[model samples]
Target chain A: MRRSALTSTLTFYLPLWAFLVLLLFPFYWMLVTAVRPNKELYNLSLNQLWTSHPTLQHFQKLLFATHFAPWLQNTMLIALGATVLALSCAVFAAYAVQRLRFRGSGVIGVAIFLSYLVPPVILFIPLARIINELGLWDRPAALILTYPTFLIPFATWLLMGYFKSIPVELEDCARIDGATRVQVLRHILLPLALPGILSALIFSFTLSWNEYLYALVFLSSTGSKTIPVGLATELITGDVFQWGPLMAGALLGSVPVALIYSFFVEHYVAGLTGALKE
Target chain B: MPSVQVTTAARVVRPAGLVGRVLENHHALGVMMVTPALLILAIFLAYPFGLGVWLSFTNATIGQAGRFVGLGNFRYLLGDSVFRVVVLNTTLYAAAAVVCKLVLGFLLALLVNREFRGKRIVRAIMLLPWIVPTSLSALVFYWIYDPTFSIITWALRRIGLLHGFINYLGDPNLARASLIAANIWRGIPFFAIGLLAGLQTVSPTLYEAAAIDGAGPWQKFWFVTWPVLLPLTVVVTVFSTIMTVGDFQLIWIITHGGPANATHLFGTLAYQRAIQGGFIGEGAAISAFVLPVLVGAVMVSFHYLRRE
Candidate 1:
């Protein structure tokens, strides 16, 4: 009996352990390649797990010699700015749909989300012309302007779920106590829906940070380009992939959000699940 | 922000008397809250979405705007052989990805559902591909498919699966297959977790009851599990299909719709023409064609997924 139990345990865990190791190895290799001396990278028989001599030269070059720092800064700035804009717009819209009795409100909610699902490829061509007309090409504000089209509907939907989950009596009591509707929202609903709001912020920022097609198409100059486009074009020259610097840039780019996501995994999944529920 | 009286007038929900005025004030506040979103959507989303429909009729270009050529772009697209290929590729990609993701994710959910040690950690890890920024993950795959010094190539070679080095992206047939593989790798996690959440809501006692009735595992799954999961399956599958069918970044970053345009889905092909090849009107028409189909699919799925 013990033998059978032990065999079953081994059978179950071995595959899972192997799968986990395989899944994580590429990320581990990315770290190893980022740190290993350039000479050791070509060594076919080099140990896959660890390197003896690690250096920060690749990271240094990525930061100083390359334009990674400024790109990182721009991504952060644009992502944050876009997040703020998307959230403010989305939250209000969500609240209005959830709380208010208005004409065509449900239709508007459905319409906005359907609009959000319109692919960026379809939208960016005309938007490029519009941005040109507005004299906003190559500007970070372009992202802030274009991002909410996608972010707002989804964020509004997410916040709608959260607002509906809130008890109606809280607002009723606040209204009876002479709080205006705006006051009730500010004092009661917004504070209560903070988790939903945070999830929206994270999603909006992440979406902005990761957006490539518009950032590539709208922004013309290298200085103005976001990290994804900049790194893809500038970091690797013709016939040279620049593994060390590219991996370093990728690692730097992903660390903040990955950490943020780990911290807010529950809320993040809740937001997605909430949004996914019709 | 606007004329206070005008905005308030817009907000009068049931203008009966004094209470109506107060409710109008609340309605005005709601309008104010919703304005920023409405403004952004109007200019950026609604205007552009409307313009694409308009441009589908005109011969639009990036720099030199062309004269109105009614149905010219759409008519041209219908004849274009590559456009047909793109439509087929997109349909195949979405169908294959959705079907496989459903099957594989369902299996994984079932496996993980069984009470296991370190199940929490496994669940967390499973969500990584979905949570990680797609561009970052795509870059990782880019290197994994690197012509030289690829660990995947090394593994394949070690297993004697292929005798020589495989330039997966450079070969036409292999390139499409490879792009699909990369998409499935990223997509399965979201489907798995979403369906797993749905599965966790299922009562275990139902399974026990099935067991007592002498139902085998496969029979129990078909009768008990499949029906309960159908609605969620439709929702998750349709959502992923819409996103995948219009996927731009992964293909663009990896292959640039390369090796003689073997990997051109509707999104990438639209991008290629609009941005790279500079046939903006034709590109807009292609995407406009896709939009209605997507909307129809979403509406159908959403209608079914919503509980009666």
Candidate 2:
């Protein structure tokens, strides 16, 4: 038994630890670098692993000096706007397609799925032109509107799976008991599908928060840029790299989505696998 | 006779007004419900796709419109050496990164599936790389790969494993490898967690049956785990392929297709040409090349989904 335990530890624990380190080292490095003093950051003699004197100067500078605060506000605004819009649309559409049994629902379902396959890479150029034509250039509303192009399909598909799992008998019983179709949806389907809807909300918010190319292409001004675009484009000036402030920005930028994911991880995993399982 | 009379009476007492009648009609209600989503998609997705294809056939610049040039953009791209290099780099990048992620991610799934202390926390931590914004994590990689004062270089030197600083992003070949490594790092959590979900669905009795039949570990996996994992693998693979192949953010942040544009994917190339260089037609054409591949992936996934 002891021998077997030793073998298992060697086989499992060691490799797992190595993988964890490799996967997480960057975040650790980001944290360390974010806190390290500029004096020690440039001083090659100091150990890179730990800091003798850790500081919050970088975070203070990021919040006070740069456009980081505005960028955060912009990112939050866009992500929330996009998530709300996408979830509302997706809920109605998924309900219609999954439960309504209307004509051509299958075709619509397939089309929505196909739309998810259309990556932003293919559409960003023309989208740039579209945004320009709509007079939304350098505006957060551009991302708010266009982000749903991707988000709706995903949210709709995931919610469809959730709606499918809920028993149709519940809706049928509600319909028979003097409930109108809209009333049935509001009272029965929506309540039971609340968990699914919450997951979709979280997923959409995180995705919108992480979105880059669209923000980069659509918003050009410093004040209008999102977190990803602001940090990447505005942080560095010419040849100078501000490692401390940049890492601080990265760490701060990741915190919101990371926090949300930690709370709803099970739902997040279920939503991910649920969509594919369908 | 009474039941038939009652049904006839109920039919006559139908929903009160036009609004109620419309809501009662499945076709009308469904159309109404779907209109908002379809409107957004039509205006944003479907229209832009067609516009993109049309723009690819013209010589349109950022400010000035151009007459249709038929196949001029495609013809020019076919002749351009940089475009050719981009095509190769994107293909190599996607193919290599997806394969590596599959292998390593599966290994990770297997490891994480075993019962362990702190398994929940470990699983949650594993997904951090994926949950973090790509651009942010890519910045961390950019710093890690810095020519001067790279922690990687410091650590390696301290271990006596190296004598000289490695220019990870300066050399063309090394830069490509660096970008792929970063992509795989960001991608593995997705596959590992996905496959782990699939792993949990397998029945323990199947493994017991295999063990009772004298099957070894490899044999049991081949006979039991492989079949169960195959469908999820195909789905996750196609999904990852679509995202990875059309990737822009990582490349944009880490290299910006730099060191003489050695790392330009279709997305980055399109941005460079159309958005930055003002050659909208050429950029549209560059991005349009990815459509056929996307269609092919969608078709494959659909076929698999339909089969099940």
- The candidate that wins on DockQ is 2
In angstroms, give how far residue A38 of model 2 lies from its true place. 0.4
**Lowest lDDT 10-mer window, candidate 2 chain B?**
B5-14
Please give, as one word, the docking class of candidate 2. Answer: medium
Name the regions of candidate 2 deviating beyond 4 angstroms: B1-15
Model 1 alpha-carbon miss at residue A121, Å: 2.0
Clash count of each predicted structure: 0, 0
Prediction 2: B-chain TM-score: 0.94
Cα lDDT computed for each candidate against the true fold? 0.79, 0.93
Regions more than 4 Å wrong, model 1: A2-15, A18-22, A45-50, B1-24, B159-162, B208-215, B306-308
Q: TM-score for chain A of every candidate model? A: 0.93, 0.98
Worst 10 residues of 1 chain B by lDDT: B6-15
DockQ of 1: 0.50
What are the per-residue Cα lDDT tens digits for candidate 1 across A1-278? 99988886676666566546645665776787788877776665665346899989889989988888778888888888888888888888998878996666778788887776677877888888899999998999898889888889888988998999999999987766666676778999999999989989888877888888888888888777778778876876877648888888878887887788788878887787677664
Positional deviation of residue B281's Cα in model 2 after best superposition, in angstroms: 0.6
